[model samples]
Target chain A: MADAAISVQGARKVYSTPGKPKRTAVSNVSIQVESGTIHGLLGPNGAGKTTTLKMLLGLVRPTGGTFEVLGMDSTRPSGRRRVGFLPEQPYFPVNLTARQAMRFYGSLGGVDAARIPERTTALLARVGLADAERTELSKFSRGMLQRLGIAQALLGDPEVVILDEPASGLDPVGQRDVRNLMLELRDRGVTVLLSSHQLSEVEAVCDQVTILNRGSVAAEGDINALLNVDGRTSVRAMNMAELPPQVVSVAEEIAVSGGMWVFSMPTEQTRAVVDAIDEAGGTIAAITPKRESLDDYFAALLAAHTEDVAS
Target chain B: MMKRIWPIATAVMMDSLRRKVVYVVLGFAALLVLAIPSLPDYGLGVESAVFREVALALSYVTGLVVVLSLAANRVPAELEKRTVYNVLAKGVSRWEYLVGTWLGILGVMAGAIVAFTAIEMVVGYFTYGELMWRLWEGALATWFEMGVVSAFAVAVSSVTGPVVVVTAALAALFIGHSRSTLLGGEGAMALRPFYPSLDAFNVVNPVAHGSGVPLVYMLSMVVVFVGFAGACLSVGVLLLSRRDL
Candidate 1:
């Protein structure tokens, strides 16, 4: 659609080295991320997720297909004027202080020289690096470097941002901060394409996800749609020390903790279970359609994909 | 264009300073230049000329070492460290990155050449009682030649690693300076124009033994620097554009 901020159509990449077999890093992978949304790129180690992102960002050459950001060819400098990227485990020249490094990147991002000082201050503060602004990068910790990478990617307030393993070396708090930052950017109408191995991080902020396996898109869609469990609903009840036998009869995946009973059942039997719980003097805390955790969904998706490839 | 290139160039220059290679080479060469007056085989009334020749040679080697140490590793190290991703991903063209890199190395070489020449001039003043201003011409020639060398290294490094880049760059230097000796045959004379040469930037003969390089020759070296550096960088940008980071 015209509204799609990033469109990768039939994207393919093949790496050729002398005296070795040609390796296909990405094949026929296409994804469309609409404006102002966070799209997660998911895959295993050799699944071409990073390669695809690299091709799109012009960091790697693509053997086939078209990649566009805001309808512009993102592989060119002019088209990338409004885009930003953070490489996996991003590194910078150790000789530069954090502020100077930001200035250098800000200039490359086409930010006004006069505005760089202010923008650098604000962005470093945003990423919690304000205190380390003048510290040379050689002295920065892994977590600090990752924060600086995020700060640099946000310079010039790019319309589109691509992040590869943005949380790779961060502690939990830093990862959370990055997630919050991505959400904040989305709220400001910035499009984000995040490539990450951290499934929980992806599940937390991604509106849509594209999973790759063996150099192709194995699955792609809204996060909820991909993980939703069909024909099932989850029920949570309170105040009853024990679940009534009638509710248990149809319930599956039942768990009791903190004096609350939680279970999933067939969607058709939701009414029967709710009625039974009501009769048993239990408070129906909530009832919602059940969805599988991303971890489980991803594992099964790959397992099924492996089977498909094998057979 | 300048906006992106200048920052990268400055960053390269700043980064180079922290690495001890430049100062170490410069210091060693300066000490050698200071000892140039003591060469015992100077001909009658040609002692200053000999000092100038040895000093000029020291300057050239010092410049090449500084240039090679920086250029040979700058691009490859950046690629290996993934530091270049930050710059290129910020919308700067690959050509800009290469040129900016060369500019930074050139900038450092210029600084080193001047500093080394200044030491030579001071030595010449104390030893022979004349400023020996001709060494500046030699320094300039070395600066331009090393600039071309750095460009070649940067271009080659776009597709390879530091070791290969250094090897290729040194080979280039050898070939660049050997066009006269290696292609002296009538059969090879036809290929002279096609072969890239570092001869234009070689003013050592006049700079070390005579009244120094002419103004016009000095201007032509700039032309040659532009032609050679531009060609090398164009090739580098082309190769880099196709590379996968």
Candidate 2:
């Protein structure tokens, strides 16, 4: 569709050797990322997440698939001109200073020589590496290098950006910075495809997510749709020493923390609970659909997918 | 395509400058070039010729060392470190990457050979009070041969690791030069045309003791270099394209 910024269909990768069995890295895995949205790719180790990304970027040869970026075939050089990728644990030539490294990647990204310095300066500052611009990569810490990788990927103002574990080696603050950066990119109307093992980061920023399992897409949808607990509503109230008998009778799961009472119950009891709380002189702080944490949902989903394969 | 290739090549050249081996090879060769006049028992008139011979030999060995160190390890190291991912993921074609690598090795070799030749020229002037411009011809010839050797190293390195690539490249060099000895018999003479002989690049004979080869001959050497290097790089690109990485 016209709204799709990135599309991969039936992607399959099989590695073969002269004397060994052919190993399939991915199979029939398809993903469609809507334009200007943060699309998360999630999986545990060896789930073919990296392989599928590589196949789409032409870093790995695909046995079967069609990959497109911005309505062009992405498995070719020209298609990737408007795209950028930051690989996991990215490495650079250690001898180059950060500025020189940025210029090098900029040149490859088709940035003009006259504009490279200005763009490089801006990107380094954007990634929090303005002070490290003159430092050699050999002297860079892991987090510093990760920041530089991001700076380079942002060169040439690519329309579609792919970041694989962008915060892998970062501290908590750096991880938060990356999360903020992703949100900022989305606000700028850029399409980002983020592959990360850190589900918290994904849950914080991604609008849609695709979770891979054993080389196939195990789950894919909007974050709210996937994580929402159906037929349940969560409620929080303040100034309530004790719930009214009517509210207590309907409340299923209840907890009190920091002077606020929280409970989840069937969505059908919405009007009765609000009326009871109002009559009991309690303030209704919040009422919304209940949702499970991504961590819990991911574990349960993978366990079920694995059990199904085993059976 | 060439736009991307040039940047990768420039990066390779810049990175190679930071390695210690490049300086070590050039330094060792410079020392040998400086000591060429000190060989024992030389006739006064012919001593300069002997010096020229040793100087050209030094240039050949120096070029070979520099080329082997660079071409044998660059691709393998990039692969092992996954640095190639950044370059290729930027939409650089595999052929461009391979050609850019070989071209970078050639650029470094050119610099090394030029520095060595400059040292030889200065030593020649101080020792004999005459310019030995003939040595430039030998340097040119040796630089071209090294280009061919480096192409083979990069080609073989695409599919193999450094140690095996170095061994195979050295073997190819030996066979390249020993075509006559290996195919000397009347029965084998028919196959000489097909064997890739590097003897055409052996311009040291005329360059050191006499005037350098004719302009036409140097032009033919360029043809040979273009043919040999192009074929090797083509095979390298083909092999690397088939790889999963």
Candidate 3:
């Protein structure tokens, strides 16, 4: 984590309204996003994901703890010069056209005045709003505004990008476009911190993930490390009428579909299981570690955390 | 900082142009100025002075309406709509945002005042057969006063909604111009020096009844505007910096 692109350590926020009880929105939540990788932040609503992001971007003042970007204090404006943020449900002045809005953001981001127009044109096209550059924002659909939000975030050529629900309100095709765009940014070595509710989206693009429940980190690690069941191997073999006796003895979870046998067995028994399938005149279609979908894992993790709190 | 402040200000100016309130108020005020000479109270020798007085009054009212319409809702609307996230996330300080918005409102006021004054002068020339150069002085004073008012409204709008911003702004305006009336007693005169009076920009008597305001007084008015606007915007920046957006 020494090369962490963004870090939030011991982050906490407390809200105290005059007539209401003080509420702790986040408590000691910490995250580390490494350089040049996509890190997914996942949580249920009110889990402090947005609050933590807000504190890191200087939009919300943290009651306690440290937030940093590239080793600089991100709570200050100067530290955010190299970082870009897209809030959930981004909005803009309805009177401005896409080009004018981009110019306004570019100037605030300290982009060179002479270069803003060129950047505006390229970024608008990059986000699929090339033809809508002159269209007023009031006429833009929700998806188009989201795209414009993304374009403005990149106006400064920021090294780090923080996106909250980046694919929200996008059509399926538009969501695919956003996914590809994120991959392109990654290929160019830009570090991205993504907070999303789309488990499938996170599962596809994230290198690592941190899940939160009730204002605290429920789990955190590399995606593969978290999702892969230890000491287990999954096998998908075709042209097998039935599992061999030896494979059957070791395999626990087994199923058959489309004339193919799928099962998971102890990692140590993979050689014997493969040999058994070979001996039975079956072809091994795939063999790898047993992995659970992010959806299942996220559900079980939150459930366990909730039960623990209730207990 | 001007690079940052300039765009926000221009955006505000651009936004104001789209709002119908600016055009509607100016249109009504211009028609009034054109009809000033036909008033039934026009005297034998003081027709030009009365016309100037009426024209200046129209200019002030027009500027006030335009300024309030722009300032009272710009920040609250930006915050409610969450458009400010784009600007502040780009390394622009909160103070820069406040000042930029204030300057933008001021820019729109400048345009409105100048346009209305031009209409007044045109009507005066055609009806009275003389140039009304003093109206420009009236326009300047009106613009400066509205600038201070816009700063207050923008500052208050930073943390509240439009209704509260407008109400508090109108109250501030009343207090600003009512210093002598509220503190006219002998004992109150001792506290007058410390009061936040906005009377410095009130040049109606000089511009309408006598020679134009002295050059020295105009210079001092600039100082008052700077002091008042700077103080209000500073308070706004402080409040906004603490509040979570």
Candidate 4:
């Protein structure tokens, strides 16, 4: 099998709105996800995250470009067979029990009938629905429904799992459980592609992240490398009058509030600012380095894209 | 493809069977079929003629019920509930899904039709002291007619709302039944000069000629209507596959 679970190049999707020119949902967007990694497709609303996922799953045809999944063309049935998907809001037959729904989806995946019962039980237990296995899905809470959606997506042990906003409408505890389950799936060597507006969840779970804006990729790389908040440190002093001019110049922004100097510094000049403060005989009350989160990184990317579009 | 289609169709059948609507429709059909023996007392016609007339009317009513309850709701209900996305993403081809669903609902309607026909036959035998071949023939024609009408209902439900699809299908049924009479009229035939043009309209009408229930003609009409239904359904699947959902 290929090392990349999903690979897209120059993918584009255009929907022709009546009485208007065609609108592009994804434009020349390319993405590559390695096997056994949890990749996050992060973007603001209407940024084409769902469109990209739909194209990858062959749910919608692309206007341009090529993509492959699990060593087969994405448009082919063989490639789709290796994929398990959780739609943003999945529905089950109202009268069907959790067990029955799982069995139905599992059977569609061609799982052996003899093994379905065992697999269904295991999946229900995994999603913390063991007690409600026989309960009708219509009676399930929103959180329980989301968990069941995960359980169904895991049926037949698919090679790649795509979850679109898996944690949306979930409570804090439900979100945490889903995040843990995603990590567990990753650990077990399953490639996962997840899309979410929850930056904290993406930050905590994703190994690689791709930020999109206006139907195009704004930034793509390892989460840690892209979101590194180096050279920025917070400082506290008894008085602001003693701060030096050279230190002030190097500080990207310095705000004095609650008797503390918050310095956003240039990446290469943090050491110089600290030394200058010491040489000037200013006593540093506290110095704490700040780390940029996925939220901040995405915000910066989106802001840059807006500026680019405006110009 | 067949492997994937069979399971989906099985699921559809199982789900439809669990709906209370199916039982209500079946019970009403059976009651109408059983009530035929009492209709001769109205003095509208001979006893056997009245029995056959009432039996045929009962079949049409029950068939309409079957088409409405079992067929019209297949796709619209799924789409409304948002469950269509789950099955569509399972790598099942659109055509397979449509065909499987149609067959599943068809099976349920067929079962109901057979049960109602059997009840009417038993009631006839007990009341009239002889088997009525014409009534049996009418029942067979009704089954075929129902199959064709239900297929059209399914096709309509694929693309339109439940209310519109059912109403349009019922309208089509009325037109199809009266088509021969309309076309045979002197003024109507005179207005359409082109033979081929007239023939085209004739093709859309499913009714055929015979006194004691046109069995062969009814069978052929059902087959042709099913072919039309298949074409409509294929178009529906194509539209659905390209839809944003």
Candidate 5:
């Protein structure tokens, strides 16, 4: 059998509200995540990223099509046991200590009672909450609560971890810590499905990405492949005015900053620009190629999708 | 499956135990039941009469408290805190969750009922120089009545807001108390033409008769009320499971 961790085929969800026309949250969406890969689901607010995650977790029944997780039906208990989830906003019983919450979740996952305490302690320490083990959840800060959320999601060491906006309310250091954790999990050969509006975080940790727009998949592929702009090169020179007319005409756009001329070049002619600049005696200060970051790529995809919808 | 349900029930119990409303309501019920002895001297009635009235009133008050608190917090708290999403994502079916919560709330309500009954019994002992067996029977009937009311509140909470739930449950309680009259010969004869099942109203609407208390009678009543509660709770769980949370 193929080792795809998740396989969604033409899945769709429609929410019916009283006195209003039904709203389609996910529209005939199909995607797949292979085993041992970090997959990022990227979309703007209300673009069905969360909806898709919910469907994969079997929290919502799909109106059309089907999805499988870990080679079993998403709704089956055996399949769910191999998955862990972190919701966008997670809350715990106010009186439960961090350690108690872990043990509670662990027990629900059918961990042996004798092993739960030791495992809970180890998990709490791994999540950097060992010091706060005895603290009541009611007293936790937003960042602390998020850490607890992570701990609960990792309680059973699930094969597929799904997180929705895990870094939404974290500080820079907290975000970095979470990013490192995702990388660590990926290194351990766990499949990750994360949805986030923060493109930088996705770029830093995700191996593959799927961008959703207006309830449909707009783009999906390996992150590097999706973000690589093939025909783009950048050059910096001491002065653009001193360059030969032919060399300047070949430049797509040019600007002088910090006593250097920055040039954008078509990918096929970048070597020619370098040769022309060196020959023009315009002493090249720095030569670098510019590739689209995930943020830029997602923004452009969303803009194109919006334009398509509008037209 | 039972293992999964037990943790959910424990979580709900712990969550409800931490709410300040529970503490306040329970404290007030205890004080009210304790003050029954002093009411007779305040010209309310003779000592035994006062104890009976006070025990009945305490039962009604505690039942109302249970219905209001459980109904008010059931769905709203889950949605407000977003914890429902976490558990639901774990493949815990929504029906299982609702049933677990109902069991948890029922445990708390049972505790409250016991506490209030103990206070009333103590007062009865002090005022009459002996425990009233009738009062114990009344307490049993009150428990059944409260169970029915609690189930009704949970059903309302599945589909309506807290305010509406409390209102509808209280109205049901009052209507149930008049069920005896509603199922009487005159009532049945008048309504039988339109509704063939007019006689079945007594099954859903059980009214407690406090005149005499017997263990066998109260036990049978409890069985009947439990059946009603079970049906209502099943409907409640089904409705909640189908809802878009």
Candidate 6:
């Protein structure tokens, strides 16, 4: 925990209106992100993913919690000096050109005046906005603005970056760029806490994930640990006219297409299945542990939680 | 602290330059100042005094319109657009944000007032054939008063929209200048000193009809400006700190 780059413990946010019932936006949500790793925060709409990030960034006052970054309380300015945040659908002063906006945010991030222009140019080019440096933000497309948001968030070369829906308004290519950027940041030993709805993006880059449902952590921990199906092995074989009878008896899910057979069987049955395929003059193309897709895992987790609430 | 505050302030200043409100208001006020000498009731006996009075009034109105336009909308617009998220998330304290915003509006006001006053000085000089240096004194008072007004508007805007902020600011202005009229009774007079009034910034009598405001009085106006603006901004920071962006 001491080595964690970002730590949020028992975070809570309750909003009260004069004549309405108190609303809880977040409830006892805790997250620990280790240094130099990508941690994905996934949730459906209104699941408090953004709220948790806001609390961590001190943009929203938490009802109760201790948020820390690099062993300092994150709710204070000093603690956030080394952190960078990109809000969901990040907005900037539209009247400013891209270069001017970068200078403004860079200065706020405490970038040295002498280095700001150099850093701004480098960061803008890095985000694929070098050509638009002098273009006013009002003329920027949503995707361009998203890219600029990313550039500004990196102005200080932050040690820990918190991004909420960084790919919200991006195209497929831009989304790919963002995913690769996260990987690059992790490679540079920068910690990332990403709140996103793009499950594929998260699955591709995240080492760990926390799934929030209804303002609570419905599931968390290692991605593989949660998705890998225990005692099951997936097998793919080529040039098989049909699955061997012995293999078919044990294979739970079996399919054959274009002389390629794909099936899942108990891990203990792998040796027998291989032997049958070899005896049947079939090539063993690949054998790996069966795993659930993140999309499926997320849906099932939410469905079970809904059932729990309903019951 | 200045590092963070200065950037936000400069951003607001830069944004103000792009807005048309300042130019429109200043242009209209300049035209009015030019036309003041052509008033139907213009007389030869006290022409300079009358011109000074009307020019100062024009300056005040122009300053009010420009300040209200900027202060009322700056914070609310930023909040609505979520542009403030980037600033605050960069480790800027709420007080710094509010102060920087107010300071920027004040800076614009300073430029406008100086320009407008210089125009009045030129017009007054050509018409009366004497340098109406006293208009600078009026300009100083007007600028100080507008600074206070902008602080109030910026403070209110931290919690509400532009409409509420403008309405509240206008009401504060009326009450500020109407303290004696509103509090007429003996008992009310007892509470006069504690009342938040802006009369200390009013120097029309001295600058328009008599010798220019004394240096001591001008210094006192500075104190009043600082005190009122600081109090209002302190309240704004408190409100913004408690708010969830």
DockQ of each: 0.84, 0.83, 0.87, 0.43, 0.41, 0.89
Give the per-residue lDDT digits (tens) of candidate 1, residues B1-245. 99889998998898888888788888888888877787787789888888888888898888888888999888988999999989888878899999999999999888888888999999999998988988888888888999899999999998898899889988999999999899999999999999899999888789777788999999999999999999999999999887778
The backbone clash count of each candidate, in order, is 0, 0, 0, 0, 0, 0
* Candidate number that wins on lDDT, 3 or 5: 3
Please report, in order, the local distance difference test score of every candidate based on alpha carbons: 0.90, 0.92, 0.92, 0.76, 0.75, 0.92
> What are the per-residue Cα lDDT tens digits for candidate 5 across B1-245?
77777788787777777778877887887787677666535443355765666676777677678657875668667766777776766667666677777777777777777777777778777867766556555555666666677777777687777888888876776666654566567747666434312122222122222356445655667666777788778888778766655
Model 3, position A76: C-alpha lDDT score? 92
True contacts kept of each: 0.93, 0.80, 0.85, 0.48, 0.49, 0.90
Q: Candidate 1 on A142-196: residue-level lDDT in tens? A: 9899999999999999999999999988999889999999999999999999999
Give the distance in Å from residue A117's predicted Cα in candidate 5 to where it truly belongs.
2.7
**What is candidate 4's lDDT per residue for A62-134, written digit by digit as tens?**
8887878887886655577778899887778878999999988887777888888999999899878999999
The prediction achieving the highest lDDT against the true structure is 6
Comparing 2 and 3 on TM-score, the stronger one: 3
Backbone clashes in model 4: 0
Ranking the candidates on DockQ from highest down gives: 6, 3, 1, 2, 4, 5
Return the top candidate by DockQ: 6
Q: Write the per-residue lDDT of candidate 6 for residues A97-141, one digit (tens) a residue.
A: 999999999999999989999999999998899999999999999
Worst 10 residues of 3 chain B by lDDT: B34-43
Clashing pairs in 2: none
Docking class of 3: high
DockQ for candidate 4: 0.43
TM-score of each: 0.97, 0.98, 0.98, 0.83, 0.85, 0.98
- Report the error of model 6 at residue A305, Å: 0.8
- Between prediction 2 and prediction 3, the one with superior DockQ is 3
Better of 2 and 6 by DockQ: 6
